[model samples]
Target: MDDFDMLGAPQGSAGNGIGADEDPAAAFLAQQESEIAGIENDEGFSILDSGEVPSSLIQDPDDANSRKQEVEWKEKAKLELEEWHTRQNEQLEKTKVNNRAAEEAMVSELDENSPGTEWERVARLCDFNPKSSKQAKDVSRMRSVLISLKQAPLVR
Candidate 1:
């Protein structure tokens, strides 16, 4: 028999030789065969029929949750960094206050001939020199002021 004969409709009434009211098994097989033929003719069958599960099916493909978590973590980290910087600034301010107090104490110990003379000495030690003769005059004037203040009578 021809190849078509094997797949031909049941033998009695139709143009294709298959009859109406065919056996359920035969009908099922024919339906399956037709589906196979349709797939063979379709160009996209290979792509559509790939056996692998799509990534979208396995997990939530949208990154909304992950992105939100990242933003939250960044905000938390930023807050922590800001707090650390604030603490560092406070410590720097405290150090500045202490340094100022020490400088005042050292200046007070100098002889009355020059009040800020010790500051000038410190500046010289650090390799900086007064810019002009006027600066030296200012220093002497400041010294006189400090001496006069020291000599003033104390009041309760």
Candidate 2:
């Protein structure tokens, strides 16, 4: 008996009688042509898909406009950064000027009220021009407090 597959088909021969050694491309082409020749008059088929081109497939090999735009955007970004730096420097200079003025005022104030001169400044701050009877009484009380403090001896 001839050799046969489990399905009773002859061994080394496909069900179509094509041998394994036969060129698959030629066999496939012959099968397709036979199928097409066997076709009777019938309605054609139509297909529909989402129709969107995938990003990977939608590539331009030479897109100079995009590169030009990128270069322009970079230049504008750099200019904006430079302007920000200039503004920051101006703000820093203004702050430094303000700080220097404040320090000078504080130094002059300290110099004017330093050591023995502090008592004169304190006396001027305490002096009051009394107009009413109540004001005069308050001033009198202040003078007594000052005199008592002045008479007190300093402990070594």
On TM-score, the leading prediction is 2
Error of 1 at 151 (Å): 28
Clashing pairs for predicted structure model 1, backbone only? 9-18, 10-18, 115-143
lDDT of predicted model 1? 0.68
lDDT of model 2 at residue 13? 63
Task: Give a tens-digit lDDT track for model 2, residues 1-156.
Answer: 555436675457668977867888998999998888767433233222565665544676557788999999999999999999999999999999999999998778767844445444555556544554653445667765664554552344
| TM-scores, all models, native as reference | 0.34, 0.36
Q: Give residue 68's lDDT in candidate 2 (0 to 100).
A: 91
Candidate number achieving the greatest lDDT relative to the actual structure: 2
lDDT of 2 at 40: 42
Model 2: which ten-residue window has the lowest total lDDT? 40-49
Q: How far out, in Å, is residue 75 in model 1? A: 0.8
